[model samples]
Target: MREVSDAMGRPWTETGRHWWVPAVRGACAILFGILAVVWPLITLLTLVVLFGAYAIVSGAMAVYGAFRGVHPRDSRTWLAVSGVLGIAAGLIAWIWPGITALALLVLIAAYAVVVGVAEIVAAFARRRAGDTEWSHLASGVLAVIFGVLLFAWPASGALALTWLIGLFAILYGASLLLLAHRMREAGRRGAAGTAAHAV
Candidate 1:
C-alpha cells in the first residue's frame, strides 16, 4: 500500500472539512436504492437513466471533495481517479441508454469494484494516520462484496438484480452516512480542542 504520510503527517480526519459531500452522496445512494427496491418492475431505460444520474452525481461529489480539501496528494489522486471512473461509467450509460441487461450488470460491477478498491485504499490511509473508525472500511468491504456477488451471478434475472443493487446501495449509503456523522463529530471536537488550546 502507498504510504499516505510519515509519522508527523496529517491524518485523514483532516479531510472531514467537507463531510457534507459524502453525506450528499450517501443520501443519493439511499434514494436510488429505495427507488430500485420499491419499483422492481421499473423499465430498463429508467434504470439506466437513474443509475447514470446517480453515478454522475456521486462522481461529481467525489471530484469536488478531491479538489476542495487540503488532504494528502495521494488521497486526492485516488478520489479523483474514482470520480473519473464513475463519470465515465455514467456517461457510457447515458450515451447507450439501450444497453443490454448483461452489459449494464457488467458496467455496474466494474464501477463498484474500482470504487470499492479506492475507498479501501483511502480507509487504510485513514487508519495509518491514527483515525480509528470502521465505517469507511466497512463501506468499502460491502462495495467490494456487492461487486463480486454481481459478477458471480451475471445471469440473474432483472428483478433479482434490481433488489441486489438496491440492498447494496442502501447498505453502502448507510455506511457513508455513518462515516459522515463520525467525521462531523471529529471535526467539531477538533475545533473545540483548538479553541480550548487558544484560550
Candidate 2:
C-alpha cells in the first residue's frame, strides 16, 4: 500500500487533472439517469445491464482518479478500495442478470455502505491534509443515509427500486460535479497565488 501510494501515477496522470475524474463520473451518471427516464419501458434485464455498466464505469473512473493523481500519504487508498467494491458489485450483477430487484437492492446497499464510509474517512483525511476546499462530508453523509434506507427496506418493488436507484445516481452525480468544480476552483486559486508570488 505504501509503495503504491508513494509511486507516481502513470504518465497520463497529469492529463486527467483532479476535476476531470469526477467530471467523468458525474457525466456518466447523468447519462444513465437520462436513459432510465427516457426509456422507462425498458425490461428488467436491460435495467440490470445498464446499472451494471454504470457501476463498472463509475468504479473504473474512481480507480483512475485515485491512481492518476499525485496524492500524498495513504489518502487516496480508500477511493481505490471503493472502486474495487463497485467493480465487484457490478460484475456480480452482470453475471447474475436474473437476480431479483430485492437482491440488487441489497447489493447496492452494501456497496453504498462501504463506499460511504470510505468517503467519510477520505473527507477527514483531505481536510487534515489541508485540502478543505470541497464538500465531501455532506456527500458522504448522504450516501450513508441512502444506504441505510435501502438496507432498512429491502422489500421495495421493482419499479420503486428502479426509481430509487435513478435518484441516487443523479444525486451522487450532481455532488461529484460540484466537487469537481471546487477542485477546479482550487487549482485556479493555487495557480493564481503562485503567479502572484512569482511576480
Candidate 3:
C-alpha cells in the first residue's frame, strides 16, 4: 500500500539537505551564550538589546530554514510562524528597551512557548514517520521547559534571567549541533539508497 511504501521511504529525511541551517543556528546560539556568560552583570537595557539581537538572528535563521529545508507544508508553516514571532519579539524589545524586566520576561516566555510548541509538533511528525530525530525532540522539550520556567517565575529578576538564558542557549545550541549532524547522516543514507536503487 502507499502508506506502507511511504513509511518505508521516510521522505521527511530529506531535511538532510538543509543540515547546515541548524548548524548555523547552533553556532549563533553558542556565540550568544558565550556573550551572555561574559556579561553576567549587564544592565536591563543592555540585556534587552542583546536579547533583541539574538531574537532577530534566530528569527532570520528560522525563516531561511522554512524555505531552504524540504519539509512538509505543516512543518514549514510552523517554522515560518515561529520565525515571524521571533522577529516581532525582537522588534518590540528593541523599540522599548526601557520596559521593565518582568515585561521583557513575559514577552520572551510567550515567544518561547509558541515557538517551542511548533517545533515539538514538527519533531513528532518526523517521529511518526519513523525519522527518529532525537535531538529535535530534545530541543523542543527544552524550549518548552525553559518557557514554562520563565512564565512561572517572572520575579526572577535580570541576573537570574540572564543566567537562565545563557544556560538554555548553550544546551539548545548543543542539541542543534547534534540535529545537524544527524541530518547530514540522513542525507548520506538517502544518497546511498538512491545510488543503490539506480544500480
Candidate 4:
C-alpha cells in the first residue's frame, strides 16, 4: 500500500491491497475444484502427459541455455543438473506411462507438505512481527490440512491432488489477471480524479 508521487507532485495510491484480486482468485479456485471433481480421470491423465512433454522441452531448453551462458564456468554446473534431472524425469515418464500418474501424485503430496509447513512457519513469523491479519494463519492451517489429507491416503488422494492442484493453478492465474485489471482501473480513476481537481 505504498503511494507514489507523479512528476506533477500528485500522489497516487497503489492498488495492490484491493479485495477484488483475492475474490477473483478464490472464485477461479472453486471452479477448478469443481472441474477436477467432475472429470478426475481425464484431468489426471492429461496432467501426466503434460508433465512428460514439459520435462522433455525443459531439458532441451536447459541444455541450450547452459551452452549459451556468458559465464560458462559459473552457471554450467547448475544448468547441467537441471538438464539432467529434466531429461531423466522425461525418460522415466515415457518408459512407464502407467506409473507416471502415481509418481506425480506422490510428488505433489510431498510438495504440499513442504509448502504447508513453510506457510505455517511464515504465518507465525508474520504474527510475531505484529501483522494483525489472521487470514494468513487460517490459510496456513488449511494448507496443513490439505497436505495431511494428501499424504494419508495417496491412492485415493491421487484424485484429490488433481482437484487441489487445479484449484491452486486457477486461483493463482485468476489473481494475476484480476490484479492487472484492477491496476488499469485504478489508473483510470486516478487520472479522472486529477483532471477534476485541476478543473
Candidate 5:
C-alpha cells in the first residue's frame, strides 16, 4: 500500500490495488454516453425492449432460485417476491409496447430522483465524517439536477435517458477494464517487491 498525504497533510493509504478496473469502466461509460446522446430515440426504444426481456429472464431465474432454496427460507421468500414483481413488470411492458417507452421514462425518472436524493444524503454524511468529499457533493448535485430536469420535461427525458444510459454504460465498462489493469499492475508490483525482499 502506498501512503499519500491529503490536503490536510494527513497520511492516507492508497489501497487501490485495482485502479485500472475503474479506468476501463469509465472509458466504456464515456463511449456509451456518446452513443446514447447521439441516438437518443433509438436508444430509448431499445432500452425499453431490453428491459422487458431482462425482466422476464430475471423473474424466471428468481423464481427458480426461490424454489431451489439455495439460501435461507427468508431468502427464498424475498426471491419469490422479486420474481413476481419482475414478471408482472415484464408482462405489462410486453402487453403494451406502445406505452412502454413512456412508462419506462417515468420509471427511470423516479429512479433518478430516488438515487439523487440518496446520493446527496450520502455526500452530506461523508462530509460529516471528516473526510474531503467535495467530489461526492458535486456528483450528488449533478444527479439531483438531472433528475429534476427529467421530471420537468418528460419528452426530453425519454430521449435523454438513452444518452445517459449509454454514457453510464461506457463509463462502467471502462472502469471495469481499468480496475482489471490496475489489479494486474498491483500484482506485478507485489511480486517484484517480494522478489527484492528475498534478494
Candidate 6:
C-alpha cells in the first residue's frame, strides 16, 4: 500500500484534509472588517467587543487546526502558538474593555507581530513539506506589514485606526479564503488520484 504524495512528495492527505479551518477564520475576519467599516464611529468598548469576538473565533479555529490538521510537527506548534496568542489577546480585550487607546494599540500591535511571525514560520514549514501555494506566505507578509504599520502610527486617531484595521482584516480574510479554496482543490485532486491509483 504505497502512499500517494503531492507534487512535492508530501502526502496529499496532509494538505487537503483541513481546508475548512482557514475558511472559518477568513469568514470571521471579513465579518469583523465589515462591522468595523460600517461603524467607524464605534466606541472603545464596542471596538473591544468586536475585536475580542473576532480574535477568539479566529484563534479557536487555528487551535483546532493545529490539533487536527495533518502537518509537520513544527507547523503545528507555530499554528498552536498563534491560536493561543489570538485567544489571549481577545481575553485581554474583554477583561479590560476600558483600556486606553494607547494600551489597546500596543496590545493589538503585539498580537499581530506574534501571530505574523508564527504564520511566516508555519508557511515555511508547509513549503518545506512541498505545498506550492504561496497564499500562506503572502498572508504572513501582510500580517507583518500591518503590525509594523500599527506600531509606526500609534498616534493615529481611533477613527483612522478603525479604518486601518478594517482594511487589514479584509485583505487578510481574502487571502485566507484563497488559501482555503486552494487547499480544497488540492484535496480533491489528491482524492481523485488516489482512487485512480487504487483502481
Number of the top TM-score candidate: 6
- Against the hidden reference, what TM-scores do the models get? 0.91, 0.84, 0.87, 0.45, 0.47, 0.92
lDDT (C-alpha, whole model) for all candidates: 0.81, 0.71, 0.78, 0.49, 0.49, 0.82
- lDDT for each residue of candidate 6 in 6-86, tens digit (9 for 90 to 100): 334567555667888999999998998888888867898888888899999999998998887545556888999999999
RMSD (CA, Å), each prediction: 3.3, 4.9, 3.3, 10.2, 9.9, 3.2
Q: Any runs in candidate 5 off by more than 4 Å, and if so which?
A: 1-29, 40-43, 49-99, 154-157, 160-199
Across 1-199, the per-residue lDDT of candidate 2 in tens digits comes to 1111123333211222477777887888777777776776767778778878888998898788677663434557998898888898889989998898778778878887887887788777766655553556666776788889888884864546666667777787788788777766656665565578799
Q: Write the per-residue lDDT of candidate 3 for residues 30-126, one digit (tens) a residue.
A: 8777777888787888878877888888888889887765444557778888888989999999999689988888887887788788789878765
Highest-lDDT candidate: 6
Q: Order the numbered candidates by lDDT, best leading.
A: 6, 1, 3, 2, 5, 4
Candidate 1: global Cα-lDDT? 0.81
lDDT of 1 by residue, 129-160 (tens): 65666787898899899989988995764456
- Indicate the residue-level lDDT of 22 in model 2: 78
- Candidate 3 is scored at a TM of 0.87
Number of colliding residue pairs in model 2 = 0
Candidate 1 regions with alpha-carbon error over 4 angstroms: 1-14, 70-72, 157-159
